[model samples]
Target: MAALSRLLLAALLAFAAPAFGLAQQPAAPEAEAPQVLRFRFKPPADGRLAYRIVQRDRVVFAGTEKARAWSHVVEVRVGGARPPDMLEATITLSDVRLDEGPADDPYYLVAKTLEGRALPAVLHDSGAPVETAWAALKREVAAGLARHTDPETARGLAAALDRLDPEGVTVLYRPLYLASVGHLLGFNTDGSVRSYDDYTGPGAVMVDGRWAASAAGRREGEPVVLELGWRIGMDPDAAARALGPVLQGLAEAAARPEDRAAVKARLAAELADGMEMSERADAEYDYALALIARFTHRHVLATAGYGKEAVLEMERIAP
Candidate 1:
């Protein structure tokens, strides 16, 4: 009977040992530290790269909510194996949807019209378009302009209507513009220097197989893997200098409360005149597009209130 009791006690303790051991087990070997990959910007070789970009924009004014979202796939190909290369990019927009809260929204209309169109563009090292791919965009915007009846906004848009380069409009509306700008900024003129440090923040890291930056302790992968935070505002002095007498008159007129409405009207007319002048006097559209691209890229990266958000995911499709 003594031997039997001892055997039974041994069995009971053996049964409880595993449960006790589990309670003190060392936490599964500390989850094996996450694999981290430090990103280095390599000058892209002569290969094709593909990416899917999702863009979301939302606006709220006077308790009215309006939202517009779209997704597009971009394909970029590098032509030369060496520096001073040419880039051929194609953007195809899809899944564009809009939710407007019973408010008059023309932007929603524009987005709807832009869906399902693949725009192909080519650019040289200087960011000059090698092909005229603005025909489709010009047609679309012209139609929208004709249909747009809002006086307050229409005038401003109409003022710069003819001067609207597809590249400039694209930079305003899509994330692929950033990719183009990034490509240009990533490589030097001769493709000798590849510096990505200027575009990445201290918190940038690879997380879950994607490059991400920590903002407010949360990882964000949008438009860029890292936040460049490039904000280049239009220099008022430069604008004043460029406008010369026109800016002076507008400034003087805007100083008076009574002349505000008149000043606005004059401003619109002057802008229209300036567009006409730009078209007739010089072929500065290419240069203007370059400037606009840089400005728009910086503006998108810097401004949080624009309600514009873009996510860029890169996949190496070929060697």
Candidate 2:
């Protein structure tokens, strides 16, 4: 009887084993792959977004020099709407302060001139001169200079402006362009990767949450930061027709003998230390058009071969 009882117990235990094993197994719903975060622009509702942009520059004239920085508080707003993919936006400079440079520094002067100015919304892709915006900024700079009571200070500021002429306005206004359109250059309507070559190329790098020109070596902290407070959609072609006046102005400028001579001199200087002028018939108009084309078609952000960086940081200040 005992042997029969043992056999029955063993058979019952064997039958329960498979059931216990099944119960112990954990069910996994599914394994999902990690998603990649490709860069793209998502516009906010139509309104103003405020941001603080900071830039640091370290120049080594002899030995390692001290780092310098400047900042601007800007308000950005959508000026027009282009659903889904494109938009137009304006960035206005509300305030500016130089944190790291001497008052006489050219960089500091440039920062001072940028305060209380509005960078009008314009097409990033449009190969057109931003004459209207440039004119407005020139006036703004002049007004700022007029406010300075000190003769030396005023003269220094004026000299700085002269040195940065034509290019100075472009440099100052470029931050607005980059902040507004840098990310858009990375995408297309079909959701394909757009070529960086078409815009800024490999001269820049995305840092923190913003784009920066690539640095030679890692700095202890970010040297530049562009905190984007807002972005929204706008019409892509609205600023295209605005180029008419600028083009007309260019035509007029090209007709001037002095302007033509200046272009030739500049071109000659760029070719070599002592490039010979061609004795052939002077193509002044052609030279002017070439210069305009070169300037107008340039990337919104300046390209650096190496040893430079741009750090962009985006933040939302409004719903």
Candidate 3:
């Protein structure tokens, strides 16, 4: 039986080797997968971008001026016997407006070229150096756009794109700000607010004022990072009107230790209503109240700064 078990194990190992393509392993182990390139396009500028990935002096992959808002994926396998060296490259951007671009321009191109296209030319040229793809891809893109009127040429361009691997190319762009009073952005490991400004690779952009983050690429299980910041230019009256009383109540409760439980209960009830708080303290109070209700094992509502009369009002639910 022991000998039979050893033979079974040997057979399993052999089967697993083929499953992992280990039987076809070259003299050297497979090279590590190339890291995806990252790019950031913040507000106030737009321009086209292009890129080419060359391996063994052949354009393994090439793309031009895709929109930034639409994430893209491109992949290319430099098919050959010898190991291929992957080269990554990008283009520089100048201002171009979305309104000015050709009507047929793809969504990804619009996103990539946003900084140059969206903002004023003067402001666009002024702010900062926008990163983009390589010159060769840009040149090809320009040539391709010129052929848009020619059906055959346009078809060839589309076919070329189809051949390119659609695994790595991605784009992210900011959308309009909401009218909400407050939002929670994400943070980096070092505690700085994460922003498109700080992005060096494809990362999530919390377009809806920091309460959410969406990854730029479709790669499975990629980590999405967030950082919170207040949006300027929102109406102060709106925020104040929304937050004032809630903030005051939280302040009062925080100051009264004996009333903490009642305060917590109130916060929990507010949270249960699916209300969005304009102040961080109120949000924290809601979170604290939730934790107490979940884990405290005893009701603390009597001490929630509410007198006996108020306690009676809550007693039905407090237990």
Candidate 4:
């Protein structure tokens, strides 16, 4: 029986090897690869970009799996006074829709409110807003919330504003600011893409590539590093909002000797790793544009059996 099983396995490998086309071995580096590649945007003459973004999320918890997605179109226009390297833009959002999953879900519903809304000043390159811009956005957003006359809605919005204040709003709005620019902006010299193996990648600009690769080139081929891992910060404001409340509650509750003992014992069991519950994942990006024309960054969360995965993707829709 063992010998038969081994023979069958060997036959399977023989068949699979041919079907898989061996291993897609790399060509001679000098022959196929450019001396260097450039992966930076060539801004249009109008200093405007029109794009479509799709946000997707899936979760499996206690034997149930759920997926949700939102699609929206954004237009960004840049100009006015700013630093040499930095640029400010008015970002407009429209045509928002819940593309997949639960239609009544709050996560999907919130996107509807963004229809025809415009952010006055967000960084053109990074998608993040400047400090003053953020302040203005927050004020405008709060005013919108205050327009709710119902007691329940008003209270809920007030609580949300308080809780999401400081950095929480930024965390939630990161996708809006980013619009998947991270994938398009960070390329090494020679137009090469981000290297997850090294932290030097990401958050770089065209100038950074000029310094590293000497000069940028129009990529005739795909990126050298096609697939790599990326560490994404989904809810950077977590420490202050939900997590902070729990820690603060624990501190307040541990006033008595018995309470302190109980709290310490519970923490010892739960917090063995010192305040980090995270996993690394290789985010998904579709280089439709990266290869030749426009592109999309389909940033996905690996989840690693934790059962929570998300994808924030965007595409260049118009010239």
- Cα displacement (Å) at residue 239, model 1: 4.8
Alpha-carbon TM-score of each model against the true structure: 0.38, 0.42, 0.18, 0.52
Q: How well is each residue in 111-205 modelled by candidate 2, as lDDT tens digits?
A: 56666756665433221113225545555665566453255656655645644545343445544443433333222222222222122221112
Clashing pairs in 1: 223-310
By lDDT, the best candidate is 4
Best by TM-score: 4
Clashing pairs in 4: 36-190, 37-190, 37-191, 38-190, 38-191, 39-191, 289-294
How do these models rank on lDDT, best leading?
A: 4, 2, 1, 3
Candidates, ranked, TM-score: 4, 2, 1, 3
Overall local distance difference test of candidate 1? 0.32
- Global CA lDDT computed for model 3: 0.23
Report the poorest 10 consecutive residues by lDDT, candidate 1: 276-285
Model 1: per-residue Cα lDDT over 1-319, one tens digit each: 1221222222111211222111121223355433222212232454444444444433322223344444444444545422356555454444544332322233333444455665666655533334435555655654564443355444455455454443443432334333334323321221121223233211111012111111101014322223221211122233223443443342332245676566455444433322100000001011211221111221111011111122233222223
Better of 2 and 4 by TM-score: 4
